[model samples]
Target: MHTQPAPTPTHCPYCALQCGMQLTPDAAGEGVAVTGRADFPVNRGALCGKGQSAAAVLSRGVRLTGPLVRDPGTGRLAPATWEAALDAIAGGLARTRALHGADACGVFGGGGLTNEKAYALGKFARIVLGTSQIDYNGRFCMSSAAAAGQRAFGLDRGLPFPLEDLPRTGCVILVGSNLAETMPPALRYLTELKANGGKLIVIDPRRTRTAEQADLHLAPRPGTDLALALGMLHLLVAEGRTDEAYIRERTRGWAEARAGVMAHWPEYVERVTGVPVPRLRAAVGLFADAETAMVLTARGPEQQSKGTDTVGAWINLALATGRPGTPLSGYGCLTGQGNGQGGREHGQKADQLPGYRKLTDPAARAHVAEVWGVDPAALPGPGRSAYELLDALGGEIRSLLLMGSNPVVSAPRAAHVEERLRSLDFLAVADVVLSETAELADVVLPVTQWAEETGTVTNLEGRVLLRRRAITAPPGVRSDLEVLHELTARLSPGLEKGFPVEPEEVFDELRRASAGGPADYAGISYERLAADGGEGVFWPCPATDGPGTPRLFLDRFATEDGRARFVPVAHRAAAEEPDAEYPVYLTTGRVVAQYQSGAQTRRVDELNKAAPGPFVELHPRLAARLGVVEGDEVAVVSRRGRAVAPARVVGTIRVDTVFMPFHWGGAGRVNAVTNPALDPVSRMPEFKVCAVRVERVG
Candidate 1:
């Protein structure tokens, strides 16, 4: 029943590979099939589980077909016409703006927004709502990495070189990143690195599949990553592995770095990190011995009390060893979401603008204002982060407009987010599917999914590839950009291009906006993309004449003095550690099959079966202590909330800790009981290392 088609160009929907796919759609038009194309720059003839099944997502049932409004009086949702829905939403927003000042209103968006959508949304928030309170979920994932990388190395990209270049690395130190389960496809790079005699070091509490391939796995106690990193840095310095030339001529903070590490050497670090001195010293040796190495950390390291410091400490590894700035030899944050890097690049983060420019910088504000055609002073500067944003609701926030994000279920302190949403004077949500947070919204706007939209997403490698539309959006759903245009026309500052009907035109605006910023796209034109077809190109790519810097900092860096500074770091304990009442440390992460919260992934038949529900993974000895058996429901309690789930006894985890996936809610909102403590440097709320007690839910 299968018939293949002639060569055609396409894009993959997973893990930022942006692999070129030759899609063979049934001529009669039933379903689409994908095969890896040979010429793809990131991946050649290789598609991961998520990419191979991308077509299946289009056929998945339960897409939001029509606009629906929850009747004010009846309090029940009913299919409504677009006119009626739009009018209702506009009226409510107008009323809310009149009741509360514009500053009382805020908007949130997704990192997955296309360049055009990101540009338009930033314009709309500034010119229309005129509010400084705007941010997105990317705040929780990579803000710390972005902040630290910019300050330390001058630029931040998930992979400084092509992912295929990992094989050329001499060593790979994965600190607090579970790539095997989270992004299975990206893990291919690690395997290649290992095969070439490159040592692999994994620093995590649980023994994951990634750890299985590792040369050494350091199972430090929860929230002690900074301690371990400091200890490693101390070893590197004590043994004379410090790159004296790179430190002296290039770095400005060596004296401070050396002092910080010496202040907390082996003895203090071993006590806090729970790692033996010999093993710690050995791990440092491997990092220093490798001539070329790459260091990567993810949410696990950045989602803690000292998340930013953890990332800075990881950077300390590359600086001390003289490994950064070469191909596959830099410190990079493995960004999680599909468009996580691009999301924050375009003003969705609390204190940033499009092009990765900060809000507080006058030059950045002036540059963005010129693009936006507004006074620089009109654009608000820095504001509170995600956790603080949630807590500010109802108290300082009177209105909220959410696009493509589920704050209630996704944010830490779930109970608080839910309460804050209910307390809002007006709230609206735009999504293609009915979500837990959308159900509580005053107006729910329907939108298109990935396959139904035409746009571009910058992948982890900083490669920008076109996301081609294969099929029409289901029923009356509109693109997010389209809806916002119409909505803003009725308000002040007016919409640019007035209800832009074409996606190409929207992307055009983004290019102009990027004229002079960190993520410069002035050279990337729609015509060029059309000519290039399916080839993914990295950013800072000026034109065909200019070759994109495959790897950054070959000699100098993007810092104020052209030299990379070595930032010093100190270790801090987790906000919540094991206590008498809650003696077990609970860590939350994702399973391979399920995406965040299982919102869309759970509906996919294959993905759902692969990872059905949440489970509390525990060591055999720990399960025995609670008299809990495999497949038996057990109550896991923490300071904020509790949930009962099946026990999965495994020897992979330390006896003092348990692991669970954070993609479930209702009674399973892990963040409900998770520590809401903020990282001092990153301002990211802690999602890992929460103190909890597990008991059989008899």
Candidate 2:
């Protein structure tokens, strides 16, 4: 190995907070001891357990190399040469296609992919596979927010305003997001700026670590966040705090929204949400009094049965106050995944094409089709969503292609997902390591890790940051771009030239693909990216001579008729409500120690040591009633499945609700018993609130 390089600072590849890290290089020039850096917008460079120990994930402990093939007889994965592996995969896939048709094959990806990688995945799925059943994990993270933003305004990312925008806000409402654990860096912005008579309102079922920082923590009844939001809007309208001028000039559906809020006032809200009328009214008044206001939400709010409606209500809050398009004043969705925005922009979703263009939009399709050198009319899509494609596994979908996602562990209804995956005639998973989902694959392609790969990730605040290569991939591991290129070459002839050999060259293709598109990523060339240096280049960077947009809604909005429409949202309870048999509301989320499904973090011993295994948090009253003490192993069952995990008795949750982290997979997988019911509009699973019964086991 070469001599070690000096230690340098980097950024976390997991969450969108993009927390900066200081990496101490080993003598071999590999990343070691990743620590928080000195200066950054997110953490000022502080890292929780996940960020601090991120380097351990890239260690040799659990990394997969070459192409892995599972032996049907032994049911164990064995290494196969790249050629043999590809031929086998190609033959099986070709056979499946001949028997079941193109509609029978599907692909699933996630927001963790870099922009270049996401664009490549989309192109590969459409041009090579010719299948419409392609979607990403965003179906679980950003669908509701995306739907709401499009319905009200025209675009979607997160936070309509930049993060520091919090400093200028008079009031900030955080709905369902656990900022302290999920995005501590974002919370740092709030905590540092939130003083001098500003209001911090938190809405959740549990009194989380974040709740402690809130000026008023409204513990709404499980699945009742929408009711509380509507009630607050009712009070805002009644108090005459809404901006009539802005509304009259920039809104379309105000009359209906006001009417709905009027019909369901504080009394109705209090009854449904269980948040007292006085507190609800006070929160509404605080928001109304603020000259600048922001409504921020995360996956907790977006991953529900009525998620889209709830997000629509948040949009109305900003539009009603006339704070939209202004710094520190607007509605924002705190995106969960690292490249969530990039994934959405690059046609990773089932219904979208490259360049933030819709599949149904003929011009958008023509633009990408021309760039890809394909017939625009030949593109088969407006594909099936994530849940629908997964549900179709055994029947129409005979082959499954999953890249950079562990849906078996991360998707709702873990048991069902695992079974569906097993039913596939062929499965190929591309990841840096052999994840839980990878273990189930017929062929697992060892892909490059964050440290070993070079690309870009769009942070939570709409800033695109470069992911410089710090180390080389292991002997056989290849970048996902490289793997995809090889796979598609075998399936699709004449398209080999499209997949460039270099990563930056691939990014150039993506840059051109998005020319004149909504997100306007066209002008962002590879040379500009290199010269732009390590800092972020905020998007809508449409011109090389023009400054990139750091904050949105600065000038009106990108809406129909040049006026933003106020989307009227009626309160709808979660898809599955608590009842006599499964009375307790079980909610799942991230922990400070691990990232999603423990695909990366669990590989890190230090992080896993801090948060070892699955633990269901229970309120003191419920734990006492259930006869389960702290550390007691218990069976948590829902309509979908069951999980046995240790119980940690705490007073953070309401007596009727239990909180569990979604990191664990084996037996304690939170998704094991979680609900998979989708929102009618967004098709996002109800991950926030599901009914379950807890039983203590010896």
Candidate 3:
């Protein structure tokens, strides 16, 4: 009798949606085919173009199948055995540490790494290398939102309520997010909200496709989202629509927040934001009138020099409206990277310990140190944020171990980051492909990707999911767990006790380490996750017999007084403003067909054919001012650098602002001209708004 095995279920590799999918192996036994899984709640039977074509990267020809070590004789990368590659990496790291102290060695991680990998990488950097120079690419993704959430609510989860609540809400204010393009599957939530007779309001500098579906769209100047929010707050108060009872009972510090908004009158905000007062009043009416409403923000508002304060302003508005901690209403950030919520929770971030614990806190240090079998005093303190760490390379930091991120193509002031990377004395990178960053590495280790590995990832909704190993990895490749285990064994020698090669074993330790921290995952396990027909469990699952929490802050917040705090914030100009030298605002975002850095998605033939390459999206007015027509080569010049791409003139964007998708690399890379100004609290760069001048290229 001939029998066939059942297809393995997993999650998508791109974006924070983490859409559920099933991989069925080909009968010829070569590659697997991906299909949307109808059972998962997040994206029930729905997959984006990137999700449906994810399996294409799993082919042996598309990904790196072996390790490569730089040859000193020829100054080129050459194939090498795993043993040799690992040995070379160990030698490089050891040499750097011995010659320049442990602080000279650094570890850079990514948001795409699974929960297990993120945990292991953080542990390796602290315990094995004993360096405080560890951070992940996620610092650039949601650090501002995370900082604002923690400051206001004392806990940071992407969404306090799940995605299922969206359709039930009375109204939703979609701020600075293009869900229709970034996460196509999530756009249905807005459609469903409208179908249920709920109003949708979108705030952006561009009239994006997502904005077109909104009942009202407010087009503001780049970097003025804070002012727009303040204007709305001012209107809410002047109209006497503030939820006084809810504000008094459920929150604190409202008086200060109220006073701050009063100064920025609607007329004043109109001048700052270029959004009319009437439209602002209309937005305030829709929000205050709704029985249950929500505010959702994405990269647009959070990728600025004032990102933390900008996000805090939004939280203040939500608090004033009594929206959060209620059924079907709250403030949430649409986390961008896959596992972004989980990646930060587990401790790949610069300033935190496992389970989102403060690294400087004695209790946090003592608790996590006990789980890792280390002295509390032995663990390193907080390190620099992502951009700062990258900037310090070759100066204070000499060697770097980069995993899963292509920062050369993604970082703000990317050209400077590439220069810093080139300056590093020793660099090692582990990724599925030869990314732009990997091309400059001393050693490149090929690692198994999503479908080839079994691990856990936390989605935007705080739902912890298990991505099962659906297919065999290409020969000569290794899982990140295996790579971490081997490297730890080499670096620490006799002290390689905690590092485990199996994902489940590491996850068990992670649970214990996260037992009592803010983002606790103690109750979660592979068994519990695999149970319930693989629906996955939410976090704050503290006990083995208990059910995880789906909605948060229903009764009280995570604050000391059990009430959310209102952080007083005021609007400010961006780090850079348009002037005579750079007379236009430059805003960057994602295109529907391409994902971040274009590391993996660009390899897909279908995606490439659809997007082809990067282009400068300008308002028709700006195109004419530059004397350029559609498809004409144009150069966007900023103080940092310049990028040349074909012009894409359209009426969808504001006349004062120009837009570019930050996906492609090389001459078309927009990040090359982005500002690296750090937010005071969150240390996030001004990736969304910069000042630039456009000229037609000859």
Candidate 4:
């Protein structure tokens, strides 16, 4: 008698939505079958194509199964034993530190790493390599929103309120997020919001599929989102719709913010933003008239030179209307990566410690160092941000260790980043597959992936969910934790005790290190997560017996005065603008079919078949002017670099703007041309808008 085993419950490996799924062993025993888990409340039995096809990557030929070491004479990578690979990496890192000081060894991580891996990577850099040059790709994803949220509310959680509150809100002003394509399962929230008679306003340069469902779609010119938000605030004040009572009781610094908004009149803002005054008034009217409303932003406004101020402008709008802190009303950011929220919380960020503590704070240093059995003064201070670290890869930083990221295809001015990586004294990359960045590494380690390891990941809502191991990894592969453990043993003799190979052991240490900090996880445990039917627990879960906090700032903000701060900001031009040579605005983003860097998703057959390759999406008018039609090869040249792809002529985009999905590499790599102009506060690259010239390629 052959009785089938029960299905293993897990979450999808792709987006922040973290849709739940049930993985069952296949009949032939080749791989697992993925299906939506109806019991989980987040997705509720809905799964996107990416989620459905995630299992394909776990197949034999789809991913790396062995470690590889570069041959000095041949300049080629060849399969090698684990001992040889780890030894080479240890020697390289030690040699660099001995010759160029500890600061010369740089460590780069990604947003996809689990909480345990992120924490361990941070500890490895500070203790083993004794370097302060540690940062992750999450800096590019949510740092702008994070900086703005912290400045305004004194805390930064992706969504202070849960996604379940969307349908109950009276209106929602979605800024720059194409949820329909980015996370399909989340699109249901907007659909339910509309079904509940709530008005929806979408602000984007293109009338995307998500915008098509909006009651009003305001197509603002790129880099002008700041002006658009300020104009809305101006109209809210002019129409006498301001919630003076709420502002007086729950917020501060309104006078300066109001003065700033007043200077940008509706008619004046129209010229700056390319949105009409009537539409601005309509957006204001719909929002103010509603009993409860919410403002949610994505990468659109957060990936600019003024990203922090841009997000702050939107926050001012919410505060003026008395939206935040009220039921079903607030300002939130839609984080894109799988573990974007948790990745920043657990010390992977450049200036943060575990639990989102400031690295420069003496108390934070003492607490974390005590957990690791090290002196507080021995801990290093803050380092450079993501772009800055990449820029200094071969110069100030001589050797590098990278994990879970493919910066060669994802970073701004990627060609320059690639050149920097090539010039490094020695580079080691640990990834699930042979990513573009891995191709240039001196040593490559095959690590266990989502389904092959157990760890916790905090979603966009700050919910800490556990992803249980469902299958055995390949023979030659090892988990990232194991790799760190082996390397730590090689670098420092006695410090190996701090680097645990088991995920649960590493998590237990993380919990202690994070105790009493901003993103406390001391109360959370694998037992609790599993006992709760894998629904996951939210953060600020301080006490063992206490209920976790699902919503924040109900009665008071996290600031010292228990009130949100209103930052006064005004509109500004992008780093580069249209001129005689570069007459078009180029904006880059993701498509539904492919995820960031296309490291894992591109390997999936179904995803590749759907996306195929990159294409330059231009307005019909722009395409006509360039004498190019749909599928015609077009070259987009920017000040930084140039990229060529087939044309996608559509009427949805603005005539002066062109769009490109940053997934592929080689000639179609859009990031090769993206400007590295950073936001003053967040250090996020200006990926949303840059000046370029479009021409037809023969």
Q: What TM-score does each of the candidates earn?
A: 0.96, 0.97, 0.99, 0.99
**Candidate 1 Cα misplacement greater than 4 A, ranges:** 1-8, 493-499
Query: Per-residue lDDT of 1-698 in model 4, one digit per residue for the tens?
Result: 44565788999998999999999876556779999999988899999999999999998898999999999889999999999999999999999999999999999999999999999999999988889999999999989999999999999999998999998999999999999999999999999999999999999999999999999999999999999999999988888999999999999999999999998899999999899999999998899999999999999999999999999999999999998888899999999999999999998898999999999999999999999899999988899999999999999999999999999999999999999999999999999999999999999999999999999999999999999998889899999999999999999988888999999999998889888998999999988999998889999888777678889899999999999999999899999999999999999888999999999999998898899999999988888888999999999999889999999999999999999999999999999999999999999999999999998998
Error of 4 at 397 (Å): 0.5
Query: Model 4 scores what on Cα lDDT?
Result: 0.94
lDDT of 3 at 401: 96
Ranking by lDDT: 4, 3, 2, 1
Question: Candidate 1 local accuracy as lDDT?
Answer: 0.78
For every candidate in turn, the CA RMSD to the true structure comes to 2.1, 1.7, 0.9, 0.8
Candidate 4 backbone overlaps, count: 0
Which candidate ranks first by lDDT, i.e. highest? Answer: 4
Ten residues in a row with the worst lDDT in model 1? 492-501
What C-alpha lDDT values do all the predictions have? 0.78, 0.82, 0.93, 0.94
Better of 1 and 2 by TM-score: 2
Alpha-carbon shift of residue 399 in model 1 (angstroms): 2.1
Q: C-alpha displacement of 396 in model 3, angstroms?
A: 0.5
What are the per-residue Cα lDDT tens digits for candidate 3 across 1-698? 43455799899999998999999987777768889998999999899999999999988878999999999999999999999999999999999999999989999999999999999999999999999999999999989999999999999999988899999999999888999999999999999999999999999999999999999999999999999999899999998999999998999999988999999999999999999989999999999999999999899899999999999999888889999999999999999999899998887898898898999999999999999989999999999999999999989999999999999999999999999999999999999999999999999999999998999999999999999998889789998888878888898887666888889999999999999899889999999889867778888999988889899999999999999999989999999999999999999999988889999999999999999999999988888878989999999999999999999999999998999999989999999999999999999999999999998999
Clashing residue pairs in candidate 1 are 346-354
Which 10 consecutive residues of model 4 have the lowest summed lDDT?
1-10
